[model samples]
Target: MLYPNSSSFTPTPFTLNGIPGLEALHAWLSLPFCSMYVIAMVGNCGLMYLICREEALHQPMYFFLSVLSSTDLVLCSCTVPRMLFLFWFNLREIDFSTCLIQMFFVHTFTVMESEVLMLMALDRYVAICYPLRYSTILTNPVIVKAGLVTFLRGAVLVIPFTFLTKRLPFCQSHVIPHTYCDHMSVAKISCGNIKINTIYGLTVAILIGGFDIFCISASYTAILRAVMSLSSAEAQYKAFSTCTAHISAIVVSYVPAFFTIFTHRFGGHTIPHHVHIIIANVYLLLPPTVNPIIYGVKTKQIREVVVRLLGGKRGY
Candidate 1:
């Protein structure tokens, strides 16, 4: 049960717990993060430009890639810039309301990205399993509906979770150990019993991440079975090739997610501070940086389009 009367709980003003000589460490970390942020932004922007400009790439798969790239760009922008600023100035304090807003956007985009992947898996399933009807099945109207559903799902699911987090009475230390205000990290500051918040978060994780992963796996399994029965070697090869990028993306996206969730729930504060920082950053930043590279390697047309759009002479 949630504790009522949280309005009376006075939160301590947040202050920076600056470690001595930490300026050097902050600089060391900021350099790499800034580089990664630049690469991720350029790569995703390039993907979006290619898809938008190239008429040949107007199909549903590339359409989904464009959406995913746009979402990644937003997600990266939401988290990384603030983190870089914090590290550069050693400003460790954030207003409570600002922290809540940041958490909302981070979780919202995270869910939206997961939904886009699920849509991508479904697109591949239709293309492979129902080749004759693929185009008709994935018409623009249908893709727009899928996008709407993804957006609404993220918005509706995250609203309640954010409210639940906000209602928690924070009467203890306000220093969030990690760079940003993660759900678990913020919940830790609440002086009241956090059973409700923890349970709600776990439930959302299972429903959002777990259910999406399960659906994607089921779609791909059906896809693999259909590919196996195809008599043509070329068809089988093509089918398998389409999935390689998505498979890599799924692995990269989920591993760090599960690691952070598991550590937050089970590891408690026993884990070292540095380890938590690493896992937190990986969960927030890795997908945006790696996803474009995965698509570039697996989808030749996208790579060609990206190259041409970047003013390089390349043909698919």
Candidate 2:
């Protein structure tokens, strides 16, 4: 509900439309969605296992990867099951509070993951720019603190927006067009003026996602400078090589997300709502699905551990 004047008709329960204008293709669409979901779960779980099992992998970088995997697991889980149900069975009735809860989780994990990426940039910064002090700087206690702080930031930022939907009384429509309950989609149904919510939500997104991008860029800049200062080109190449996976992970994570959000807001009525929904889901799904693959192929330590794990299982 989102208007200055409430409509005579009240929303009974919100419905998730599950990608507007794509009803006929739901069954076919489910194949790819389910495949990606399984891959995300298996890949992230496998990474988590490798990180936890290999004592040598117990470092600040892997610690951040652990957080990322956990966050991605939760992130995809928040939306995928419900989306599959919608695509397969067409069961879309979600109570108002349930919708709010979903929105909260989807947004919370998004911010949490964003913050973790920012922390990772910091990790690389310290490892490269201050190699001598890397261990001391990102020691166990400090790593734990970084994680706690990331969690607190996401919780504090997102918990309030969960209630923002409560302020809107939806007399217009209860059907959300996206695969999941999203803040703006939920607000758009309200008959009330949602400028405040819009502005505040935008502010929070920028503060979290935007700030992270800026800091990450700065950290990498310093890292490049540090790498360049190395005496030999081989040393410099190795140093830069170590950051390649992280840089790839960061780009994949943030760029599409930013593009999706931007197109959603500025693309105007010319773009179809279905396009918006797809982009939104892509933003949420792509990073988690892609991250482990990137690391598995790019990070030598993780690659070796996974190969060993698979080889040992083959032996059995």
Candidate 3:
């Protein structure tokens, strides 16, 4: 479904090829897809609300978690509503400019999410490896500055990368083989030399996301070393325990994501288009839908607040 045409082109509206070969099953598919989006919206929203309401969650780790929740909400928002509509009502027509804008937000938010995760890892590293200086290092203004820098970094890079369409021609079928517009999916449709596009995209992926992953890994290595050096078993357990939610979040966010990426980069014509699209959807859907559950189950403070909130509702 990565359609790179062999001829010259003209600009036109694009029809999203929503779940090809699965058109007959769209009605059935919409149910779970809609459910996931709803859960994602509510779960992420609830987490943000709880963090804002509970004064105890104002620490650097929780602040990063809140940023992650916001990113997840926006990322899901970029695709899910339209995706649901595409599945159920078949509203797949998207004009060129709008497509570029949507692609900008989607990619930017994704970059922001990855940055926030790395920051969270750094926060954990500092807390574990150098606890006494955690407050001095990650004060309120520092967290705010980190967020602004993250947003600007993603915005600056992704906008230029996405707007690469202005230089190419689109004489091909306006049918994109994915639910929502992606940078590569959109770029590959152009009838011009796409070598530049592909190279730039891969560079952005490697530099932004790949580099962040390396930093996160290094941070965790330091955290583990510091944790192991603690003489008290209880101290070691406590330090490691703080990272349980973050580790769960990383797993849920990255595992399906890498699978989706592999399908895009290497699956070629051999893999089913619907499988690629579904896996892509899953990669985006799971984090927002499941992260709140992970933190709720892992973080004692979050679990306590959630329990109290539910119990209060029951009393009503």
- What lDDT would each prediction earn against the true structure? 0.82, 0.86, 0.84
Model 1: how far residue 299 lies from native, Å: 0.6
Whichever of 1 and 2 has more TM-score, that candidate is 2
Tally clashes: model 1: 0
**Candidate 3, 120-166: lDDT as tens digits:** 99999998888899899888899899999999999998887665765
Top TM-score prediction, candidate number: 2
Worst 10 residues of 3 by lDDT: 1-10
What's the TM-score of every candidate structure?
0.91, 0.95, 0.93
Total backbone collisions for each predicted model: 0, 10, 1
Over 257-301, each residue of candidate 1 has an lDDT whose tens digit, in order, gives 888887888886697667766677877788889888889978888
Highest-lDDT candidate: 2
Query: Which candidate do you rate higher for lDDT, 1 or 2?
Result: 2
Better of 1 and 3 by lDDT: 3
RMSD (CA, angstroms), candidate 1: 2.9
